[model samples]
Target: MIGGGAAAGTIVASADPSLPDRSAAELLVDLQNAKVDGLSGTIVQSADLGLPKIAGLTADSGGADLVNLVAGSNTARVWYAGEDKARLALMGTLGETDVIRNGDDVWFWQSKAKTATHLTLPADAEGKKPAALPTGVPSTPQDAAEQALDAIDPTTEVSTTGAAKVAGRDAYELVLSPRASESLIGQVRLAIDAEKKIPLRVDVYGKNAVNPAIRVAFQQISFDTPDAQQFTFNPPPGTKVNESTAGKLEAELDKEHKAAESSKPAPAGAEQPTVIGEGWASVVTAKLPKASGDEAKQLDGVIDMLPKVSGSWGSGHLFSGSLFSVLVTDDGRVFAGAVAPETLYKAAAK
Candidate 1:
């Protein structure tokens, strides 16, 4: 039930029965426009659901060298040329892979098995999903319409609230309410940039409970084309590869993850984690984890990138004041404390 509005910006509107079509060229250009030649920045993100937050520094050479992407305790190195024919090793997660994306085919080299498996997108797609992130950028006008439909509940309508400035960009704000009383997202509002056709902020509120809100800002955007190599990854030797085609493996992985989560017990002294803001007020006690070399390093990097850190007051002032974070395991576990970060370091320490 996420509803949004468009500010009075340079948005091309159509009333004719014959709506406009978005050519592949337009999409490609949009992709290029959103790309930056070289970018090295930190991204900090969290959900009211209290998933382990993301904190780290990433450096890339436009589309040629992914150079490095360091996320808590894990790092990936990618290199590519042309349309990104290269290698990647996710030390902790997927091991390594050799990927080659020639115009005719996209393949992944499994390090563990020493083989290449081709990729095919779902049947319901126009072109290879654009080699770019779909976030922020709007799809075709029809795509926007589909998005609008998806945003609206069968029992709700979208109402334009007003306008506001987000991330220094002008945006239109809108509210979403259900026509019927029975609905989940009681009230949701969002801001969309009128010029770039991107989302600037999202806020969810409810009278019955705490509401969850997430805001985003963009910077240093470019229309410059990324070297095609950014999409490619290769595996180093002695790595095992598992080929997954038709999404079967993905589905299995998800189910397995759910099962693993259900089987986990509370840490030695903690209770179950809580979901705040939208539903509950005060949650159960938090758990802390053992921190070590890579994990500690990742935590340090992530801490540096914190946009706003909450649940802490240092000498009556705060630096990571805006973002809230809790350490959680891969199975969706959580941990927090007053000296939480320090405790985490000692726990994960070797």
Candidate 2:
């Protein structure tokens, strides 16, 4: 769900689009049972995380299109036909980046860099591992909706936002709000198609915010199966191609994990991530890799940009954003969550 093309403005839902009455519980069930075999659409994703601008840090800089996803807007065209065939083209001002998966063959292409990466999946791996796409860039509303739905539990309060419209289709809006006051997330609103029961838009709001801090939605869509040719990829002349198999990548990851484990001391969970809380207020704490020389200097410079804070848990630089907070401690540990700074401080103390 991660490849897309160009940047597009946000799509506003139609006002007061009337539909048959539906309860929150019924919609939840519909979302849970929803299924789509084939579809193609243009997706618009935007984020306004309220992060301070830093020099030389932009989405388009050095082909860092993923970075732009957190602070700006982007547009992508996506085509999906069942689980084995899918394509996403991320359009940009300079060029386009695309990820295509067809059966056992997967391709990643960057037009500006004239480079392509190809991976041949094992027959059994075909539909098992998701295509590697930029993290946090929901290629479709369904992707975002699935993530939001995962947070549903006793810690969440679910309700209906009534009728709405997305991508010119009538939809029902469902809202999920965190019960914990410390949770920075205000609510996650999902617009599900009335006829199809599939999500067409997702909006995430910060605590007490009127507008969404992040939005991912389809601007145009079709339920018909996309052309089979959409998933085919052939690199142009002079393009640098690197190839590997899924089995080789898995072996490399296993080797790295074993090496790391062997190099660590015998203490259990020393290098493992620890969950500090449950549900929306959950904080994840992990040990940062020890840096030296230029890496250490660069890390220090970046940390210096954040505000300094101290408590019984010690001192660190705290980055407070619209929907999340991150505390990078001087002791080479990082704690982060969709929680308040105080919640992070509490987690650090443990």
Candidate 3:
């Protein structure tokens, strides 16, 4: 269950008597205009995606664990000075891993592997950074909620859940619920700092579930600017560094995308991931590349663990958990979503 709204609820850092009474539309406007010049904090992320307890399925990077929709929790320290300077240090069982971005330089360091990868971006005369980089590390809940708030529509029922404490400060809770019944997502609650107008905590609940399945929040936070030296990084001796440029990175990603597309058994003129519906109940269907030889046998072993189901469309293995389900067909197609198995089956049949 979501314990509380980050440390905001626990710490009494601010003197606000209570959350400011505001209408849903007013809160939306405040969130849209939210801005932070500098900040530092400790963030905790927890996930109970209802993944199968598959033995030996461990993540390699601390960054990967932070965003992987699997079972577990992790903590990290974050310092953000601005778009040009930021640092994240993730603490894990293996060891601490750091991701530092200073000006045009980006570094990813894994202490356990004694390896670091560096990247340099080309200077932009306009002085505008790219919108985003596909780093595989998904944004934290606060970031995701901010992005989602900008896309309010009929598919989502938006409202306010009143005031609450977070990070020792009073906060207003903004709630968004999916209107579609097929959606596995029940609702999302964002704890917004009453004064700063920034989200300090985010909680996502499953359909009909009393508790959240995923939560990310700050345990402690401060609005003060972080030290400049935190953004600097020097690779330790004996560390393997694979350096690359922005252009090279883009080329590599393009090549990989094309190769993956070629491998999938997609129908002529059809997209790899085709959405059958929209909103919460939407199911994404993809044609997967068929495995052969030992790989096929291994895949079969995995299928055996899942519940077998069949329909007029095809036969497939169904994997269901708390908040997500996946249908892997014998014909090399996969359907997955946060919706129910019946919803997934309906998509597969179509």
Point to the candidate with the largest lDDT. 2
So what's the TM-score on candidate 3?
0.83
How many collisions per candidate?
A: 37, 9, 9
**Higher TM-score: candidate 1 or 2?**
2
Residue lDDT tens for model 3, 18-101: 444666666666777888888998887777877665433324344456445456677778888887887778776667778778
* Full candidate order by lDDT, most accurate first: 2, 3, 1
- The stretch of ten residues in a row with the least summed lDDT in candidate 1 is 314-323
Give the per-residue lDDT digits (tens) of candidate 2, residues 209-242: 9999999999999999998988889899989998
lDDT of each: 0.37, 0.81, 0.73
Q: What value of lDDT does candidate 2 attain over all alpha carbons?
A: 0.81
In angstroms, the error of model 1 at 145 is 10
TM-score of each: 0.36, 0.84, 0.83
